[model samples]
Target: MSPLNWGVDSAAIADEELLSCVKNNYGMPDFWGRYLSTVPGASEGLTTNEINFLKSNGIKIMPIYNNFRNTVGKQQGIVAARNAIYRAKRLGIKDGTVLFANIERFFEVDANWLIGWVETMFSSTYRPGYYHDPVQGNFNEAYCQAVAQSELVKNQSILWSAEPQTGVSSKTKIPRFRPQKPDCYATVWAWQYGRNSTECPIDTVLADQKLYNLMY
Candidate 1:
């Protein structure tokens, strides 16, 4: 198995001071997942200065897009991809980065949306990824169904599973890699093992080495 790296995803703005505290308290992470656009009641978007700070500190960046309230259909998915790509470019993100669509558990995700997302991203400079729970629920069902029907989604798109929540751990006591398996075969690249940490404004993630290639 590939070595796993420690990382964090936060809904709050990870400023230098906050990140410095995180480094001191939780150890320096291999990657930091930030949003391209803010999601109400969820996350704040990445700023240019924040991006610069992360890059200069040698921390890789995982870009997330969470502007949608509902995973409606094909046209909406295409629009979301375009919006994400535009934001990424505006932020000076280079080609070939993986832009993850943040599909929360509450969203009504569908196979058509997944197909549209994959196809649109495949046509763009950046690759496609989905941040969703794969253990069970409508999201998992839709994604599995979509993968079964579309080879493009099955082979190319990446999955970041938010499952088997173990809560926050100290830097010296990170949890073992035991995320829940997806219902179907997919490139499960990153696993969010902990969330809404009380000690910090971040969630813990274990990333497969393959995920590094997609980071900024």
Candidate 2:
């Protein structure tokens, strides 16, 4: 969950009903979208007041991002991404999830950033992995089989909860990838990730969980 990251881009999010639906289904899993101010002149960095508020209210914090400085597929972005992961680790904000915005064709997957992330995040945290669009032939199956390649994207871990594909609604049903029957909302609200028309996933789980486990 977490990372209103991309959700911040959805025009449909402005709808009151849908917004409520999204928040209920996906909010907590979603990281606080635009709350952090990372740069030096910036006015924020987990203030004592906010931390107290969260602690008082029993909220667990997982601040998003390494930095908004670089483009996802560029060398700079890779370094930025690595720095962000390191920052997260240093601040003890590593438990939730991280959207690996990109490792696109332009950027080689084996860059130092990805390698460091695999090493650090695995040793210190339990979070999701978000990656770039896959290339046509990822060095002949090496890319396709992310198991050995990317530690975070390990399928068996089921640690990742992807965004529901742009099309479709819960009314749509997919049989094969029905969340393996876990009742975590972070695991619900389907997304059409594969060619399959339906797959009840983390977002689907969110739909149900937030309906009951709500917060402002």
Candidate 3:
């Protein structure tokens, strides 16, 4: 497993907060997609200074959101995914470094579109195979999970980083989705943090990452 991957998510980072993260040794992934930056500066972008700061801290993997034009469930999000790849290249971020595109909602993805997009994404400088925020009720469509799984493995990828759940609400209600532990999820999470500790703690979420990581 990589020594990096421990991570935390936030909308905008304060200089001090970022500094504190470095001080505490937590990797910084300022949640820059900010739901697609609709407000024109309402959400934060990784500033030049922050980029330098990240470099100083040896934090190289940064997961920013690409605009996923997902509204009516047709999954035009692929367009955003392509654009994000370009941005990642321009910014000198590794391919796998751009971890996710949290869609307007999960499960709204157009399967065919995603399949085609992944085909293209592999050739880029990015490294990870495929990952997305696995928000619950996201996989209710059933086939999406398996299709995604196949794609990730086909790419010989790492983990599929999905959010277990939100709001500290249902830790007890959910059951583990997959039977085995995924190795790349750990690699993915640990890399996101830049460590094991910062990864999303899914009784479900935790195990899923591990299960995926083992793929390659």
Candidate 4:
């Protein structure tokens, strides 16, 4: 089995609170998967201070660009990616960072459009990853199909499967959600087992021995 690591992701965490807790508190997450923008526009990306604090603290940052509710077609893919990259750059998220395209549950992602978005990021100096539920949702499997059917997409994508209500290491032995390969990526880079509000909370995952160097 591939070695598992623990981390936390949040869409609503404040900058000051995150910095204070991560610095003073004995426990804090190894990595942060923060939301860059909610839609395909120059929306609320992270602030300069927040970006610097996380970087200065040696935190591994994974950016999530979500436009699930918006109608994103193949023609609009370039526009969406451009806006996302612009927001990321403004917030100090440098190029070459792996940014996951948020494929929210219940929303159907167009194969060509998804591929276009991934390719756009690749050309712009950023890596592409997919964030979605592995088994329970249709989007996960749909994206898997998209990648498998497209030679272009298969080479440019990474997977971040979201199977909440569990953890990287669960003593309870509950079944974990793992995305099917080829349909999903061959390897899962990250798995969101649970949220900071429930299951294995941020403090618990941050304390895991396997993730010690994640925060540097």
Best by TM-score: 1
TM-score of each: 0.95, 0.39, 0.55, 0.73
- Candidate 1 global lDDT: 0.87
Task: Score each candidate by Cα lDDT.
Answer: 0.87, 0.34, 0.39, 0.59
> lDDT of model 4 at residue 37?
69
Error of 4 at 120 (Å): 0.9
The candidate, 2 or 4, that scores higher on TM-score is 4
**Between prediction 2 and prediction 3, which has the larger TM-score?**
3
List candidate 4 stretches off by more than 4 Å.
1-5, 19-26, 38-44, 167-185, 196-216
lDDT of 4 by residue, 1-216 (tens): 434444456665436565455434323445677778643342345566666777676666667787445424676666767777887777767666777777766666666667677778888877776776666646655566667776656776766766544533332332343533334454455666544543322322221222222222
Least accurate 10 contiguous residues by lDDT in model 3: 190-199
The TM-score-based order of candidates, best leading, equals: 1, 4, 3, 2
lDDT of 4 at 32: 70
Clashes of each: 0, 21, 32, 1
lDDT, candidate 3, equals 0.39
Tens-digit per-residue lDDT, 1-216, candidate 2: 431111221211122453345445444222222122344542244444554444354443333342443342335544554565665555444354443332233434433343444444455444333333332313113333444555453431222223333443232332233322122212232222332222212222222222112211
Query: Can you tell me which runs of candidate 3 are displaced by over 4 Å?
Result: 1-5, 21-42, 71-77, 95-98, 104-107, 128-135, 140-216
What shift in Å separates residue 164 of candidate 4 from its native position after superposition?
5.3
Runs in model 1 deviating more than 4 A are none
